[model samples]
Target: MARSDIRRSAPSPRGGKSSKEQPRGWRLFFRRLFVWGFSLALIGVLSLAVAVGLAAQSLPSYASLKASQNEQMIVVRARDGTQIVSLGPSYGKWLPTAQIPQVMKDAILSTEDRRYYSHIGIDPVGVARSFYVRYQQGKFRQGGSTITQQLARTVFLNNSRTFGRKVREAVLALALEWKFSKDQILELYLNKVYFGGGAYGIDSASRKFFGHPGSSLSLPEAAIIAGLVKAPSHYAPTADADAAVGRAQVVLGLMVENGKVSADQARGVDLKGIKFAQEGGQNSVRYFTDWALPQLDLLLGENTKPIEVWTTLDLKLQNSAASAIKNNVPAGTQGALVSMDRDGAVLAMIGGTDYVTSNYNRAVNAVRQPGSAWKLFVYLAALEAGYTPATEVVDEPVTIQGWSPHNSGGGFAGKIDVRTAFAYSKNTVAAQLGNEVGFSSVASMARRFGITTPISTVPSMVLGSNEVRVIDMTRAFAAVSARGKSIEPYGISKVTTTDGEVLYTHEARSSVQLVPENVANGITDLLQSAVSIGTGQAAQIGRPVAGKTGTTTSNKDGWFLGFSSGITTGVWMGRDDSRPVAGLQGGHAPARAFAAYMKVAVSGRPVERFQTDMVAPAFQISPDDEASFSGSPDEYYYVDENGNLVEPPADKTAARRPSDAPEDPAPGPDDANRGGLEAVDPPPAASEDFLNKATGKEKSDGTPPN
Candidate 1:
């Protein structure tokens, strides 16, 4: 019994462990394996937390993100609601979530992420597919970022392909998803999204490209805007219209597959209608926009919020003007053209031959000599003193302050009426008229016509001897076109934000008549003769045109400025360095271009004839003028087809009066427009090929083809 008890009591367990005893079986192996896995998983979780913490530290806040972008971009639009240009970085008012078109949202979701609502900040299925694509292609070719993730990256991160950036993007995306609702995240994303051409935010882009708000977007328009997110520069509607349409079609197909719209519905959306609203816009428009940029501060008062400047620029007219200058301005020189309404609203401005070649906005900036074009004021001064276009004046040579001024053609009719003298561009008679009217009165007349440039009160001031901007010159003529009303040249008609809040609006003030009605009518009559029977005949376009030609000595500057079809336009030609062009004339290519541009600019507008009839104060003709009217008034001169100063043919002279003779006349030109040289009214030297662009026929020598 003692031996059995000892064996039982000391019964050493079996070689292997029992079920409840110290286990040495699969259970223990599994327990140890689970413990090791748990510890490793905990370590990995902590490591991921630390990495995410580091990434979150660098994330940018909304305020900081906004601060780095453009303070306020200026989006200029034409009067017809076409975008002229987009300048500065786009930072605009937030577009409400409701205003974001449903179609646009659907299009984005379909193209970017199908499971956007259900997916976490990081899309797992997308990640798997991305990984598969990487494995198959041996590199990361596809992205797995959800909408939330994209927003995080756009707001907080620079575009970098580093793995660390990817990790940070994921962490920030998670943080965004936790902090904001899906709609809020989407709103933020759309606002910060860059759609190119300095466009940011869907609303700004909509106004920029469509000339409307996002809330009014059509289906195809929405698809087009949505498609821009992938490759902004490559797919911007203005950049590559065809590519943008194709991408939009692809987006539509994706939308169809995603069930946002039926296949029929998507197909019904006209991709053909997805055109950019910036019609008639060209790179040359940079000149106008550049001119308008500085005025923003004046209009907006230091408010740098994104704004839409509604300008008076007519893009269609602008394009025509640009084409006219491009086709007419010859090599080795530059040209500028500006057109405005009768009330001084600037419609079009072309600064140079090519905006790419030079951005010097000669229209608004360049202050150059205006030559005989200043005769408008001289004649206006004479009219104010009761001189009519028909009033008689002796066309004899004159000397003023020891300066002798001669005709551009080097001759003067022995005795002629004032009309004959002015029509023939008789310089001697212009000097007589300037002396009769008083030089200060002539300068005052110019000032009254809105000429802000400094006009010398000296006797030479009777000739256009002041350096002036093309716009200012155009403005002076514009006042005349408005029947002697005071003019203030303005471009911006209204200023608004991207959300349609108007900041500034152009107000039409009371019209200030710079001249009496009769004087205005008399001056208009004089200008009419200048274009009809004078040097500016080429500027006529199947209608009554009234303008003047001005050429500085040595042809340093050539100008054709006038009014027709209720619009006042001006064209200037010269080298920027003020070097002489051998034979440039105000009536040459400049007149041709004015006609070319006006032909298109006046199309579809009602024909408005000039007010020629007026009550005038009768003035007695000087005894010498009365004496000169009788001695062979038939000895009138004209620029024949050969550009020579020749007397009319015997038969033509017998049949024609001085008003019927084609005369390229000039005003007093001793102190020629700020050119500091004697005014020389040479015949047009470049009319040979000027008509080919408009009439499609070569002109005969230097004669006008019309």
Candidate 2:
């Protein structure tokens, strides 16, 4: 061996390596370095294994993975399919793997975990890419979680950035893959994941955003929902529809890239086609939603599952009602209004001027004096007892049970017919009619009218002293407009589960005719006179109106209740504390609000005139009677407790303007109908327990307790 010829001679630069023959040191050094490197790698792998085992010990069992949930949600929708509000965490009915829309599955798979089917719960390639991205970007910018890993995190582990949490997540991921099939994992992830806006599942997200169920989701809708999993709040369709759609666009692009969706299908999606659901925030529709909630218990007996309350709320009318109150009612006063169809389906309701500030629904909740409005029942009772609109009555002061009621004008008119007395809303005449009709009969008439509130059986009740809810009063009037058919105000038409299972359906409490058609006709004529040419002139719209006005003592409460041929509504204005609103009167704020709301509410319906066939008057007003009356044909008289027409005193006022009418205490620019809040027993319908449990069923409008 020639040292000069050997390759070791090249290492002569280091004197020790110059001896090429003795190469063991260099070989030994290389061998030891390799051995140390292998040993460190093995130690690192063992340490990771041990760490993974420790993490596995702390993780929850995959056997317990399930579609967990919190409280059930209640979704209240309008008659026209408008979602009014969602009560709690909304979870749609669970969708089985086979039932899940294929587009949804494709969207999720393409955008979330393209290699999900091929992976064992965790994607090594994805993890490596994620770490590489972090290394390149110098921060954790994106997650590399597979669908299974994400499910494990959302179901079994809390989202955390700690290394131990990551290890535990990985271990759970493996366990989930072992325990669940790919389809099961996908189904679990979709049905249990949060999609923001208190929606916990795809079905709920579909309904929450698109106003439909999971089975009805479109491609765009599915993509939008699928994108929510990454950042629920950031991509919630209800929050920012544009951002959600933008995220959906990205998802669709990924779907197309992954061959899950066709390019043509992706391109055809219209940006304008997608609309996010928005309900119950700042929009006055909250009034109806807030009202219809508690009734669920009475409706379905402590329902806890997700349900849809099919309500009779007309969004159009509801908006109109809110606008009417907010635009017409004075700043310091709160206003409430409820409108219903002839069948008693509540079309719209306004609990207060601003429901956001005050949730107490004055429409169905508050019971106040319905001054002259109570005259409806009294007059109805008189008519029922064979009294006619033309029946003569004295306007003189009358005393009953030690209670003497005077004309609001402070002076009595000479002589007036029954129609005139009712039209002018003369308080003295109403008291006399109540006495003559027999307070018992008057109370009975009110009871038959569906008002269930406590009625003062006292003599003053005839003078509009009964405190009654607006709904009860409205219903009393509704009976008149409906020709004496029983009317019950109902907000919910039906209750159903998310799976379309029917729970409860509303039925009219009573089908029995409470008032005779003739009496109703007579009452309707009086109401027509009150609105057409009488005190209710302020409530008149272009179409015919039959309504009355009511004001409590000291103007503490003002109310106006009216109905057209098809729809009925009641309005009340007052302070929540029962304090009087200065200058408030039924003919003013209430009438104005009623007119404003009806102008929009009925504008879309055909003009249906009220029934014109009024009952025959017992004392028919003849042209000859107008020609020759007993005392100065202009004389307005009053009826005593015995139903005798009493002559007016010499000092009695001859002619009078309606401004000082007792019922409409104050006539503003909106002077016409003035309802005197009369304390009366609520008509029978007001106390319908099944329906009334819904505070909103305070439920029908009134002309009686006005």
Candidate 3:
């Protein structure tokens, strides 16, 4: 600032020598301006040179990174080491130059790179021709992405189809040219391109589209496979056979034009009749894969990219389950099945009534209220809290915190034993027990048994008000069948690289015992009674079996969950529109379907009997028989020979109340309205060993006990 200021202040030099001699100051100023402009120009040239040098030095590395990364693909294999699926960049396999079919090579070269072998990596003639054609079309239509350029874009670059990306691709293509030989780049490109439909490499496409591997493709098939490179879905054999043939014809034309095939040979080709499997299309097992994909992704996280998920799914079991539902469930009814081993390995899962029509996977996706089946948890809570199976519980109508529960049939049996109450699904009894044992305890017990959904500790919890997925409920019941161990279901067993490098392995978590063996056995015994004489009669298998039937209120949902010695199977029937099923109670079609599936699912396996513990506290003459007094309509009371009622002390006065303030009113016409009927809740009808609550004492005269 000071120098410029001084110069400006010094001013324009006007020498007085002569007017013609004139301004020496102006000449000096012009000379200085010229020098400054020259210096800036030299600096600009140096900067450009430096930038070019830096790019030249680092560009190769970027191109190399792209090439290497794009070449490596993550192959997902089954536990048996078979490639079940893959997420690769290419549509085909990476084979040596000689392994690729001559027809396929010729087809790709004739269509994609006419001068692939002649030119380095780029062809200026082709570029100019394509440029002129696109300009004449008034749109950016044609692109001259050489084989190398296409490979570069696929393996290393973003999928931006813009001019800048195109330019970058071209630059990378030339860089690849200088880095590798023509055959090397071609081989890499052939193995690293996408043929669409999740077919990453050329070998996969040949196997998928032609029903043959890359090494076995016929001329016409190879031509078609090569044609798919242009647009896979648009010209896919499955999507449009005629269009694919048309594309093949264009490829054949190019082949002949490039001298790769004779014109007569191309014309004589009668290869227009290729067809693909319609059932699976190019994507086989879409339903099963879609179902397992999210689960696999969640379990393996970053490792899922290359991991294969091998499930315990028996294809036969799946087919049988689906067929059973189709054959039995009424038309317009939707259902699902969850079948698992006693060890918790899910053998088969059928999500919807039909996965083909609906992608809704009801096995794991749909969460519906479980209805009375949830009573199992309430019973489990009581059993764990030192309550024996013979424990007496009143079945009278009771209210819990303002929620009055009605029986499934709208009546109570007064008092009942644990087994009868559960087997009969006495709603009032279950609610009373749920409240007595604490709803939180029941909810906690359900959680320990693998119910992941939120459980509410309300009185309705006893009625299966909690929502649970079919799979979750199946897994929970599997614990009982598994002999008191929790079984977390899993699909994939192991994962490895394509080259057999062991990447990751999934080990089964050891069985966790969440319930005492005796308690679980007791629960299973009670459920066995359900199948034998109670609500789950439809689940009666010839062999010893145990299960529970669940029919939610209003027939909105029905379920049959059961287990044989070997497998636990759950069946659900409902409607997609959420309409009530037509007479579809849990004990009806759902239980029948479950038994039908299990009868075959567990065939040939010897039954392993459930173990029960007798160490539980024994009651005196069965708690259900603590009192017995028969009354008749004639106002007659049949008293036992010993004394008042039954089992009374000698000194006790049976007819006398304590000498208190007031006595109970006598039975009279007006007393009935005054609460003087003296209706005492009778004890559960005790039997010699077990009591039938309905008939007072287990029918001593040999009337069969309920």
Strongest candidate by TM-score: 3
Tens-digit per-residue lDDT, 333-442, candidate 2: 88888888888888988888877677787877787888888888888877755566876666765567788887666888746777888888898778866765567556
- Residue 433 of model 3, lDDT score: 70
Provide TM-scores for the models. Answer: 0.64, 0.64, 0.74
Cα displacement (Å) at residue 518, model 2:
2.2
Query: lDDT of model 3 at residue 122?
Result: 67
List candidate 3 stretches off by more than 4 Å: 1-92, 135-141, 159-161, 275-292, 295-305, 387-404, 411-417, 617-706
- Residues 1-706, candidate 3: write the lDDT tens digits: 9998998777366663334644478797888889998999899768745643454455555344323543434444333444545554434445777998788788888888888877755688788888898889976565776898887787668878788887667666766776678877777776667775656567877766766678767778878878888898788776778888888899888898888889899988876666664423212233445555566555655652233345555665666787767777866888888888866666777777655578787777788998988888888767755566777766766677899999888888766678888889898888767766566656656765667666666568789987888887887788888766767766555555444555546676655555556677888888888998899988877887788999887798999998887688888989877788779899998888887887888776897776655343222234454233121111111112111122223333433234452321222343211211122221122232322433244443456646
Q: What is candidate 3's CA lDDT for residue 582?
A: 76
Off by over 4 Å in 1: 1-75, 86-149, 153-175, 195-280, 304-306, 603-609, 612-706
**lDDT value for candidate 1?**
0.74
* Full ranking by lDDT: 2, 1, 3
